[model samples]
Target chain A: MNSPLLDVRDLVVRYGPVTAVDRLSFTLDAGETLALNGPSGCGKSSTALAVLRLRRPDGGKVRFEGRELTNLTERELRPLRPRMQPVFQDPYGSLSPRHRIRDAVAEPLKVQGTWNRTDGPARVAELLDRVGLDPSYGDRRPHELSGGQCQRAGIARALASRPQLLVLDEPVSALDASVRAGVLNLLSDLQDDLGLGYLFICHDRAVVRHFADRVVEMRDGRAVPA
Target chain B: MSSEALLSVRDLRVAFGPVEAVRGLSFDVRAREVFALVGESGAGKSLTARALLGMVPRGATTGGRVRLRGSADLAAERGRRITLVPQDALSALSPVHPVGDQLAAAVRSVRRLSRGQARARAVAALDRVGIPDAARRARAYPHEYSGGMRQRAVIAMATVNEPDVVVADEPTTALDEERREQVLRVLAEQREAVGAALVLVTHDLEVVREHADRVLVMYAGRAAEVGPSGHVLGRPRAPYTAGLLASLPQDGPRRHRLPALPGTPPAPDALGPGCAFAPRCPLATAPCRDHEPEARTVDGRLVACHHADDLSDPLREFV
Candidate 1:
């Protein structure tokens, strides 16, 4: 209870000579919805990736629940990944188009070593319900659904493992104007119900204004208050 | 009206093979007005802008007419009268050549300008857009410049010809807030200089509020609402238009859950018999499903909705 859910300070991430994220600092508490917003190439996405250790940071500290995540090896970080997962910008790319929605949603539970044969279907059904998708859609593939539905499927998958912190990277940026609101409102509702902490990343300010409790603006490689 | 109107689109239809994208859409852009055609992706916004310049795919079965208003629609006159500044500016420029060469080639393609004259016009275009080092940057290729600057360069190439109408599609998508405001200001200034009609297509509502004089909200493939910018955006009549306004989240009053229309936007071919938006409309009735809504005037705003008469106040005013 003493430790922050996510504590990132002086985080530096680089790509060759260009520093993608420069000393970006932010912290998140339980049930807080934080948005990282900036123009394109502002290192907003890079910072989100660095937190999940998808992209290694060149320097700085990353801690989640008193655990030092920056220095952890891939094997050491494997178990911690379930509690922290990323919902990518492109839901179609993030989820396998070939896999059924149920299978996609159940993947995270299996990855975190908690999949029981009997409980898998029930858990998947529960998650699909949580994200406002019909249980019948458990068998539907990614392409069969619309953009908004696909995003909901991606969210269903992200919530399957009951992660404490979700790093959502421009999750709704690619959605239609009307559809974006549906997804954003759903995210807000889900956060309130589950007491989930979300690190929402997006380039649009209007969308972020309604969704984020606090917003951090990134420029070049640094993070500043919006 | 004859001299004041810069570009007038009359029943313009752009098709791809058998699929018609823009179906008899008509609009008029005046000398000083900022005309906006706003909708989600696949709403014929880009195609309408492309059709103006006759840049629709080669032999894509384009029909109907795009009158250059008072001017001739001949290739020579049309090119000089109207120009398109595309959305993806970096990719629009040839990767193999320098920015200077691309700009020069564009000018040479239409006008009788010499290579040297074209080069100067290119530099002036960049200068007009407020790029800091216009001369030095001319030698740089599209890849060398940042997204915002490259977009500026593309804009420069379009404005270099001093066209009468500048139709830009999603010009601010890749830019930051500061750069977006700058580009809009530059466009407004350039429109004044040439007395060009500026037709912009964007999904961003805020950009429309700031820059546009007239607003046209397209849903599916047709114009849902058309009127003065403040009337259309501030007080929308169409249910689709109202849905869009409610969907956008602003930083003011109670941050209620963003009100979202239930279903996805209808696919182009899947448009229903009555209203294209009926499937998602909360207030839709049997008549809404029987007859296609016709254009009706509500508070001076032309909206294609059966329920437009019911809408008296601004959507935000409800809050």
Candidate 2:
């Protein structure tokens, strides 16, 4: 049988003496969304960070594309880093304030040695257009865009690496209701087209119920049974 | 529903140079009622909330009257008769002082009370808001309290003197769902215990639907609709109101895409000659673009839309 795109088994994360995530397990197939739903201090974010290997888990395993990532050294995980990207809550804080939108989108390609000076600009524009931003927006900095527009640009940056998995932590919680709908629609469209797996961590129940294919209700660093 | 207004505002305008953030808006907050102001980010809800307290920023120009019980001088009774429950509890509170001392100081600022009497009142106020071991917790600094407990303490401080009105600006926006409900419940309880009118400014429609007795939907600094929460939200008469409600996720069969409002709210300086919402409105006609509609009674509610009568189920189009 074909394995899931991402698998987590009994993940545990510790911050000093505190156990932030405790024995959490979940799996996601390609083109599916799995939401970690909880309240504040419930360790939803810690699980996301552990799944991405941004924070090393104290116990258990994170398997991506049939390869365990928990035991990999930083040097060994370098190539695999491009296949998964994070879209954080604060859009403006995620992107460099000094960089233009086009340069921010182009940096991933340049770092991967796939950027040619001629077609790189066009690729950035294409990515912007794919996320519903106008190509002219490429010249503007992060401060010039609205909250919703900045989040779209952040998504454009995430897509630049051509990732198979996206870890979205409270992506729409900071936005207004109308703008949040537009961003959610954009995410749905992108998932449909690219077949990307999403580990959506959100505190809002309505949003989780509406957007996720399956949900793991969490409280106090443990998954509560539905 | 026919009670006299505790606070009345008419033709209120707040402008920064050439840009008018809130344009000729009007509303009333009746005694012991929850009046909500809801809109998008640039819709001027926060500015309107500040205007209620005569607290506009440094260079902004404020016009029109904000009368509390037939009195035009709001500054005279700022902390005594009206108070603000700000968005951030940490900033609202001083980190250096104990939580009880701050509440006591708020009481002593307006009323001539002895330190011991004010301290007693502060402990009582904290106890009323469900703080555990109020007297002990009251002596703890703001940083020592949890996020939710700090919020409860702020609510306690706002109600210690039992003002006539409480203006909470996005009080629960920073909290998670469980904590949001807890904070809102505490705020509502305090409003009831103090018998004060609540002017809640928020962008969460679900909160407005559950808590507000009456709601004012703002779009681009103008009132799009105003009525009882049940009528306005359950059966909206204005297209903008319908569109905002349609965008909310609900408990039903999940749709891959939401019926989102097409464009962003226009900046104040970029507004057109006619309806401020005309550029993004789906039902905009030539007249809607040519002339602005005034608030008029339609189906027991005040709706400022040319096509209010044309909408039976506006959500159908969005769906």
After superposition, candidate 1 runs with Cα above 4 Å error: B1-4, B16-19, B74-78, B253-255, B314-319
lDDT of 1 by residue, A17-135 (tens): 99999988889988998889888788998899899899888999999977989889999998888888788888788889899998999888887789999988898998899888999
| Worst ten in a row by lDDT for model 2 chain B | B1-10
lDDT string, candidate 2, A1-226, tens digits: 9899999999999999999999988899999999999888999999988888998999999999999999999989989999999999998899999999999999999998989989999999999999999999999999989889999999999999899999999999888888899999999999999999999999998999999999999998999986
Cα lDDT of model 1 by residue, B74-190, tens digit: 355654667887888877889989898888888888888888998988877787787778888889888888877887787788777778788888988757677788778877888
DockQ of each: 0.66, 0.76
**CAPRI band for model 2:** medium
* Candidate closest to the true structure, highest TM-score: 2
User: Which lDDT value does model 2 have at B42?
Assistant: 87
Ten residues in sequence with the least summed lDDT for candidate 1 chain B: B310-319
Per-prediction interface RMSD?
1.9, 1.2
* CA lDDT, candidate 1, residue B257: 72
